[model samples]
Target: MNCKFLAIAVAVILFCRPGHAQTGATVLDDFKPSSLNQPGQEYPQVNSQGYVRFRIEAPKAQSVVVSLGLGGTRGGTPLTKGTDSIWTGTTAGPMEEGFHYYHVTIDGGVFNDPGALNFYG
Candidate 1:
């Protein structure tokens, strides 16, 4: 019993260890829905600094990716799947100001943000 208790304590400490933290970066709290957002939709938003954040719902998807800033670093940002069936992530850096096109790829399939309006250009 004592041995088991000691093992449990060690495991707890290891599990609770802090992860590498971010430094010297501040994301402003001034995010707003993009002008391309459909009425009443607000998942894909952009901050004043041009950082784009995306939220996609795909509970069973094995992977999710956005085409924003493609061919750039990390081949675009990948969304982390959450327990609530939603995948979310932010751009690695601020995007260029002006119109940019992006789409979501889930589990090898491509789809558009339901909250965003589509354009043909």
Candidate 2:
């Protein structure tokens, strides 16, 4: 019957739609290097949505972390090392729009981000 064919068509259309049903807010693809970055630096960038992304390079380091605007029990966004020996990660959520102090933790030692301009805080 036409009803049966119509039902099948509707099911196919629903199933073939692009992307799975998402239950989360979408992050816009608008990110740029922060104004506080050192000349020609690009790692410490901020997006229009206020999310912060960090990238650090340390080949011999066991672990790397950014003590920035991350909000959780861990207190920071942990960077995962890639094959290129650079560590990178993004904040779980958007950060407040303003100046904030942060540092990198490499193998349990705190160090300033070379890409970012250092503030004597």
Q: Write the per-residue lDDT of candidate 1 for residues 74-102, one digit (tens) a residue.
A: 66779998878899988866776888888
Cα lDDT computed for each candidate against the true fold: 0.81, 0.85
Give each model's clash number: 0, 0
Supply the TM-score for candidate 1. Answer: 0.74
Model 2 ranges with Cα > 4 A deviation: 1-23
For candidate 1, the lDDT comes to: 0.81
Stretches off by above 4 angstroms in model 1 are 1-24, 70-73
1-121 per-residue lDDT for model 2 (tens digits): 9999999999999667654333365767687999999999997988887888999999999988899965468769999899999898888777768899898999999999999998885
